[model samples]
Target: MNSALVRVPGTGEVSLAPADTPEPADPIAPLAAPWVGLGLSTPDGTTLARKVEKEGTEHWQQLTPARYIYKSQELTVASVFQETKGEVLSAYFGGMKFAAVGTSTPKVYRAEISSIPKGDVRALCVDWIDTVSDTEVYHHRLYLPRAEVSETEDAQWGRSQEARWGMKFSALAPPKGKTYIAVWLTDDPAVLFGAPAVTTGALDVITEDQPRGK
Candidate 1:
């Protein structure tokens, strides 16, 4: 069996930025400022879910439905954040205000969750890395131009376990011509299987043979 065909997120990271921040053009380029990492997450990692709703049109004279009408589509990413830092708290409790105060040895941080706003949209990205060796690695990324926290799980404080913030972000439609979500992959299986490489706005599949940092 070819190990290259198998994919595992050896290391995963979740980052967020302002909704208008430009999506990364280079598949493997390192993320820059404005993109703040949410820090470590639970071992369960992240979950990407897509749900499609459709309605079947039925005719009284026909045995089967005439057609299936597309009703709606929803894309969501859920994860349990292990860190309770300012970034994580701010994200989990949307519309909350976070601040760092004092000149003491360890700066005191606070997150005030007074209200939940209607549309707390943000640009979000999740990166997965699979390292085969020091020089050979595979990267996968999922990006959403506009997303909001749609649901959150209860945060429990216990002496036996660490506190975790669990939340789900629902992808929103971007500006008129922009895609709601984008995905990129390096060392793609399509290229390994000898399929022609095709580049489009919504998805990108890169091979090792291609020039880097394009």
Candidate 2:
């Protein structure tokens, strides 16, 4: 087995955007305007969790369950953001709005906790980069078109450690013609048909250059 396939994410990023923001077509593309970055996460980084609950059907004659019935599934991404900025605060507590007051050098930014409605949703993206060298780098991206803040850890305010906002965003079902979540990567030989890297060129040229027949 090739050991180069082993991945250890050296760095990562988490960002949030308006729910209506269009999903990125390219997995490794840089995020543009209207996307707010939640900076400086803890060393633990981010966790992507998927939970599935199912019911087993029992039969009197059989000791083990005969079959399992599908129930529900949940997908969540949790992270502790070290930044105490307005964007991080707003993301940690849903329905909280961040506003900047005063037009001076020392402007007061406020994020007030308010009644969170049921439909408060946002678009979330998580990125992981594994860099073996300057020329060899792999990028992984997870995108959720519709997601909501489902859980939050306590924010401690003390001198011992930095104030961190830890929260979990749960993916929601997309509209009739949309997707709930998407995970994509770049420069992974296991998934990219042994291609060490992705080539950015014209589609026609790429197809013609391929060894496989058209």
Candidate 3:
């Protein structure tokens, strides 16, 4: 059996409570602070951005809950235009377009990013870090196999802000298998993929402070 043991930082006390203990009154409050990392990659998960772009640097911005909604056993991802410059914007647009159209066709680099006519729906993996703590970090990963770019609204140009790009992606369930949401609480981000997507066995690895993913 796999297990994860959590101990309080700078103290000898273990973090686990008895099985009969009641749950927290407000569970959502614990996950109030979140950090999101968005990346651009091929349908097969290979990153498209060159190393010179400082690939892993994530932009900290407001993610409207109204845009990204999760309910009724479905997860929909969307976002409004936010001011960003350079490669970061490029990567984001790439991911959005890639999700909209499959990569089998060519992409046009004109003023407006457009792809060749094709019906290949690629995949987009959004890695979400919900909570970081002294002992471990909680992660929720969404793998959208049927992701596609939806319609966009016009943006008003003003001196106070630069034109921003709006993105919308729908994550439909694959023909077989369960939904593409994975949850894990671990000290290492690499092990998050091993955690279960559904509620069952979600915390099975809670005691595994140091785990190696296969």
Best by lDDT: 1
**Which residue pairs in candidate 1 have backbone atoms (N, alpha carbon, C) closer than 3 angstroms, thus clashing?**
none
* TM value for model 1: 0.80
Q: Is candidate 2 or candidate 3 better by lDDT?
A: 2
- Off by more than 4 A, model 1: 1-3, 100-109, 185-214
Residues 1-214 of candidate 1 have per-residue lDDT tens digits of 2234556779988899988678877547778999999989999999999999999998889978889999999999999999988778888778576678888868876666665466678999988888867976877778888888999999999999999999999988878786556555565454455655555465555656766564
Q: Tens-digit lDDT track for model 3 on 1-214?
A: 3334222222110011111122222212232112223322222322112111112323347433323332345444555535443333433454322233445457433334657533323344444343335656444333344544443445567998666545555444454555443222333433544653222254534333556567
For candidate 3, what is the TM-score? 0.35
Looking at model 2, how many pairs of residues clash? 0
**lDDT rank order:** 1, 2, 3
Q: What is the TM-score of each candidate against the true structure?
A: 0.80, 0.80, 0.35
lDDT of 1 at 211: 62
